[model samples]
Target: MKRSLIIANRLREVLLNGHWIANTNCKEQILSVNWMQATQKVGNLNMIAALTFHINYYLVGLLTAFETGKLEISDKFSFDLPPISSESEWNKMVTDFISNSEKFADKVEQMEDSLLDQPFIDEKYGTFLRNIEGVIEHSYYHLGQISLIKKLIMQDQS
Candidate 1:
């Protein structure tokens, strides 16, 4: 019933579980692909592995800010996904993404509802709710791309 819980649920609906919106969450989509499928390039679009790393990058940075009260993430480096050359490496990245998603939701869930209105790191960045909601919207945008990319890759292979 609390606002924090509601926002956290939205985060889960997009990232972890709940199929009310897009019919697929990030966890389900990312987990559906193997290393080869994930790394497969489809024209000029970003690969699935790169997108996964991008989302996880923000999750990790936001979690860090939640813990330390400092926001230190940049858009330029968000897609700087390290080489995922092997299945084990891909799996490690997937594991970290899932772990960070849960941690991000948990941190948001535990916050006092009023905290959502407070500035995230500073007044220039807007409120906590704005950033969290931005993540959800941004994720869905990329999720749509991931879905399309996966379908394209599968079609190409067929």
Candidate 2:
């Protein structure tokens, strides 16, 4: 298998699979979440919607860069937040995230393995690997928040 394909597959596991939500199973996390109450300063900021958006953001960026050797979205708009109005919207965001992720993996599979280590200067991150690894690290970071937030939200409901 190509290195890009390998990386993309691992990323897929993390996103659709349980890696997004603690030890939760992939089948469970895919569309199992309810909408998070819009970011209330008094409440948790890392809602499910935000995390979903973040995952897609990185995946798209990764494919565009490492695969096509370019960026799909501008840096300014890449990190923008998702709209969280209701549970339905959150579910839709989750679906969009998953779909886009698969597309990203497909794109990555087309690239040469040599591209993975090629130096590309990012405006903010300084290195291409750093940027890619940052996405994985960021996803894990938010996954922790998602797990904690889910607990807090569910606990309060009881």
Candidate 3:
């Protein structure tokens, strides 16, 4: 399988099915059976819901860049990503993120393997694959953070 396509598929499985977990935390650990209460943000730093949304945002952007040949990372940081401050807003954002990501990955899966190395100039990052790799690494890194933060949030609530 192509590296880009493999990464794309792996990421989807990770995001949705708990396959590429990248961290020690399990699915049950990150999610409360009652996910609604778990969506509440307890402090200035984004809670589990906001962090989850931010993860999906980067994935969506990465896949979009790959398909369109225009790479750009968002200005927002996980700590400051638009707050999932409300349950309704958080739900929509998370749901849309997931939907966009699945669509984006489908686009990536159609590309030739050699295309991954082809250059696309981004005003911020210089090349396409460089930016794509960043997205992959960043997603896994934040998945780690999400796992850790979710644990903390659950512990406090419990």
lDDT of 1 by residue, 1-158 (tens): 99999999999999999689999999999999999999998889999999999999999999999889998899999999888889999999999999999999999999999999999899999999999999999999999999999999989989
Provide the TM-score for each candidate, comma-separated.
0.98, 0.71, 0.70
lDDT, candidate 1, at 15 = 94
Model 3: per-residue lDDT, tens digit, 108-132? Answer: 6676777667665645555555655
Q: Per-residue error at 46 for model 3, in Å?
A: 3.5
Using TM-score as the measure, the top candidate is: 1
Better of 1 and 2 by lDDT: 1
Model 1 ranges off by over 4 Å: none
Each prediction's whole-model lDDT (CA): 0.93, 0.61, 0.59
Q: State the weakest 10-residue window (summed lDDT) of model 3.
A: 24-33
Q: Write the per-residue lDDT of candidate 2 for residues 1-158, one digit (tens) a residue.
A: 77777666655656556443356533245365566532322263655556567667777676656657576667576548756777677667777777776676565556577766657645554555456556656766766666666666667768
Q: Model 1 Cα displacement at 99 (Å)?
A: 0.5
Residue-pair clashes per candidate:
0, 0, 0
Better of 1 and 3 by TM-score: 1
Candidate ordering by TM-score (highest first): 1, 2, 3
Q: After best superposition, candidate 2 residue 97: deviation in angstroms? A: 0.4
